[model samples]
Target: MSGKLARLQQQHDSLQQEHKALQQTKNQLNQELQSIQRTASNAIRISNERNDLRKQVADLTRNVADLRQQNRDLSNESNRDWFLIGAAVVIAGILIGLLLPHLRFQRRRNNWGAL
Candidate 1:
């Protein structure tokens, strides 16, 4: 009877140890589940932010294109204005060259009393 009691006690201890190991495994699995949940939440937030950044980049690209077109238009207008001014200056220079020599000859003749 004593031997039987000893065997029964050993079986009880073994069962208790097994139960404790199972409880520990359950706790570890719970912790892993919580970690996975947090990671999923973070991934969703990051995805939203990435979409927002993409929209911002698209808007900025369109703005840049508009500015580039405006710059080209302004450049063309400036070139046209410069061309007109250059032409006026060349015409005035030619007129002065043709008129100044005649005026100088007349002034010299008047001073010498030859005409």
Candidate 2:
């Protein structure tokens, strides 16, 4: 009877030690799970931020393209205006050159006839 009781006592102590070890392992696993959750949250936030930045970059690129197109259009319009102005000046100069000499000759002829 004494031997059986001692054996049972030893078995009980062993079980107690195993239960304590399991509890420690459970606590450690919980801490690790919390850490993993935090890491996952951070990763998600970073991914969202990266996506936002990409979108902003795309919008900016589109804006730059639009601005470039506008600049080209303005430059073309300016060139066309300058060409029209130059053509007008040239036509006016040519008309003046052709008429001035003819008027002067007519005046001279009229004066001679009167004399």
What are the per-residue Cα lDDT tens digits for candidate 2 across 11-108? 99999999999999999999999999999999999999999999999999999999999999999999999999999999999999999988854344
lDDT of 1 by residue, 1-115 (tens): 9999999999999999999999999999999999999999999999999999999999999999999999999999999999999999999999999998888443434555654
Q: After superposition, how far is residue 48 of candidate 1 from its true place, in Å?
A: 0.8
The root-mean-square deviation over C-alpha atoms between each candidate and the true structure, in angstroms, is 4.7, 4.2
Please list the residue runs of candidate 2 whose C-alpha ends up more than 4 Å from where it truly belongs after superposition: 105-115
Clashes per candidate, residues 3 or more apart or on different chains: 0, 0
**Candidate 1 collision pairs:** none
Candidate 2, after superposition: displacement of residue 12 in Å? 1.7
Best by lDDT: 2
Tell me the deviation in Å of residue 26 in model 2: 1.0
User: 11 in model 2: Cα distance from truth in Å?
Assistant: 1.6
Cα lDDT of candidate 2 equals: 0.96
